[model samples]
Target: MPPDPADDREAGTVFLPKFDDRGLLTAIAVDAKNSEILMVAFMNEDALAATRASGAAHFWSRSRQSLWKKGETSGNILRVREILVDCDQDALILRCDPAGPACHTGARSCFYRRLEGEALVRVKT
Candidate 1:
């Protein structure tokens, strides 16, 4: 059964995520201490549950069609401190303390560049 529209969900204590037609929700990871965005990924039901259970950031790999824990291979795990859901329950923000660079390219954040005019420019760290 679904949650009550008026008494639950956005205004209530129950956590009812609204996954998209693809059965995935957007998850954004941010630095817990500095509030810098680390990465953005997708999460399925299993990934969400794993993250909550392990206190680590887990995501659904859209390309690989599998579940993966952040930093599983690179030792750059994201230790999640808190998960904040959007009012509509379709998106989540994970505040985390990252063990190392969040990007596969070894950048501190996946978002290391900005659009300048028609080109991408690396943001000065």
Candidate 2:
């Protein structure tokens, strides 16, 4: 069943909720001027807890099945400016202040590749 809007909004405002497997978080990394989705990260229970406790961005690595802080090892830190949970409490919207490139390859974002016709070409690389 879908959760009540008020209830979920309250929950997100008061109690930071966890995301399920099917959940998808839209990480909108605006130029800090114009809002845009630079990259996205999925959060499990641990990731949510860690991010809530700390201002840092944490995500559950789907492949590794482990918790990973955005800039745990790298100096490129991703700070959470604001967080929004969907009405159904299924997905998330994170507005962040990226200190450095969000992409592991040191690009401005993870979505540097554009859809060229039908091929998935590396536009930035």
Candidate with top lDDT is 1
Candidate 1: C-alpha lDDT:
0.95
**On a 0 to 1 TM-score scale, where does candidate 1 land against the true structure?**
0.94
In the range 15-117, model 1's lDDT, one tens digit per residue, is 9998999999999999999999999999999999999999999999999999999999999999999999999899999999999999999999999999999
Clashing pairs in 1: none
The true-versus-predicted C-alpha distance at residue 96 of model 2, in Å, is: 0.7
lDDT of 2 by residue, 15-109 (tens): 53534545534344444444556677788777777887898888888788788999878877778877766665557767788888888988887
**Pairs clashing within candidate 2:** none
